[model samples]
Target: MIEALAPVFAGPLDFARHWLELAEAPEPLPRRPIALSTLLEEEVQRPLMARHEARYPGGDRRAALSMWTQYYCAQYLLSHLGAWLLLGRMLPFRPDDIAVLVLEDGTPDGFRLPHLGAVAEGPVDLEPLIREHLAPLFQSLQRHHRIAPRVLWTNAAVRVSAALNLARQQPDVPPLRLLEAEALLAKPCWRDGSPNPLHGTQSRVEVEGEMVLRRRVCCLRYMLPGIAGCGATCPIKEGQSAKPLPLLKSA
Candidate 1:
């Protein structure tokens, strides 16, 4: 997959190169890599969460998990969307087909693709990503932690919006790519008619005569010790207490 997309990884789309990788000799992969599917297992997630909690003595579990979700989602969304918008090709993104590099302390490093899936053209549908990859991952995280599904969805939405913005800023990106991204955000619902979680996840506000984008949902990073908030992009109000949100009971 890396060889096939090599040209696209150069010049303006170089940022996508870091987020996606294709591995040679699938087995014996570098680092302490774990299959993304395995990460979903209840047994696998417990120790990972424990590692995170230990790192921040008094930090809330939901905050730790929320930060982790943002990391993984950003990896897939940026790489996948960048390829589609710039190269008009979709690399494999199925959970079963991907692995993530995990550090000893349980933080995710980067994505590793051992195999490639079908390549599709531009104006690609994002429903499969939300339905196939994110929904199940978020469900599993909620099963093991106190974070709300809405919080996870909002985190994923932020990355999705970021990918579109990144692609739009590229000088070589096609007009169709911009139009597709705009239409997707404008639509109130997904193709399945369900509420589009990506919608309204961001808003543009004036900051010193400049319009800056702000996320509608707080990532709760401020609840962790020694971690700084997202600054201007954060939806948290000025002087708001850095408290983890009330634990959301699972359905």
Candidate 2:
């Protein structure tokens, strides 16, 4: 029976492989969350700071390192949750539905969402499931100082609604299309500062003084150029220019 299910389990194995590659160190293998966290801190996070300090002589490397460590920790927890989901373990909460609350002291407070419940082999009710399972996780985070007071929900209903409205104004635009476009615009803006102009349908402007242009292309640009609405001018257009763009470049 396990052999019969091997094909079905291949997807999880593949995902695990990809994650392990990103982790890169021998220490974090076999998917242990605590071990992965430690490896990430030592291998990835610490190295990032050391490189940053070496390259850019000034600025608070310590503060940047601290922030990145917190972010990486959150990401590690989320990745562990994903691995557990792949293994069929029922999670105590849904990280997506709940928001990450950040306190003034830079700790995570808790999460908030509609109630949740475990469903049997029939139809599922997501609302109650979120309340029962996810809420407790949020409460635990709050109690443990793993989260802060400010909440950051994974579901972007408000942003999605706004996007839908914008899409409605334009004829023949799909919801997925709008989302891809928005993500492309938002990612670089948050990560390295300045939105990737290619994602924005609007015309580009040359801002005076201290203008930073971080040349980044969205994944959709590589995977689904046709859906991205770039037409012949798609970033993935064949020949020399089709090559993927780098995420960062120094001014």
Candidate 3:
């Protein structure tokens, strides 16, 4: 049954059927409000951090949590939100509507999109879908996590950017029509320093005589002491003078 549904999904991602049920709310919403970020941090983010720290050892606890929160947040965006970007669809943005699935390690596994069956079923347009449905999700997440709307959206775009690049490399599924996906990216969205998706529909970047896909924001992954340096895409790395955004360079 799962194999049959694989093609419709983004790669290196999967969902637990039970998590999907919880996200859907079972026709009776819970007594308490659902706060996605809080839920994820407690249930998913912190756990993953603990696992990583256990396995790797050495790092400031608070900083590790922050960095792992950013990393898993990016992973969540990559698997769930990015699936929509690849399909050019949208998911519901309400507090109760957005839920994440995670591995036992607390890494983001995938997501459950309540009331988003139609979009998942396909044949939808990307631009209107993102603006109407997704934009609101970022706003809601901002409220829940107390993170900036731009920061949340930027994390999402970064994962989307990574997913597209991964798709190009693997080509296991039909290659994402990047040019077409760019149309969705071209639509105005927010990021740390601007009101546009930092990735802006392109993935690979050239920096200082090298091609790199720099993270538009520091995942804060480096702040955890003894953790490896920022990812290849980090704009704040040693000797890097660039501000982390405005993704593409002129031809």
Each model's lDDT comes to 0.72, 0.31, 0.47
lDDT of 1 by residue, 134-214 (tens): 778888898878688778877877777777777766788889876776655667788878987677878898877988878
In model 2, how large is the Cα lDDT of residue 28?
A: 27
Give the Å error, residue 153, model 2: 3.2
Q: Cα deviation of 73 in candidate 2 (Å)?
A: 12
Best candidate, lDDT: 1
TM per prediction: 0.83, 0.24, 0.54
Q: Write the per-residue lDDT of candidate 3 for residues 76-192, one digit (tens) a residue.
A: 444444445444444554435565544544444444555544344534445443444455544544454455544455555665665566556544433344554554456555332
TM-score for candidate 3, please give it: 0.54
Candidate number that wins on lDDT, 2 or 3: 3
lDDT by residue (tens digit), candidate 2, 1-251: 12311321243233322222122223322223222222223343344345433332333333233233334334323332222222222223444433333323333323222232232343222232323433344344344333331221221112222333434454444444445434533443423454432233332223455333222221132322111222332223431144433333234
What lDDT does candidate 1 reach at residue 28? 34
The list of candidate 3 runs beyond 4 A from truth reads 8-75, 81-95, 102-109, 113-123, 127-150, 170-177, 189-209, 238-251
RMSD to the hidden true structure, all candidates: 5.4, 15.1, 9.8
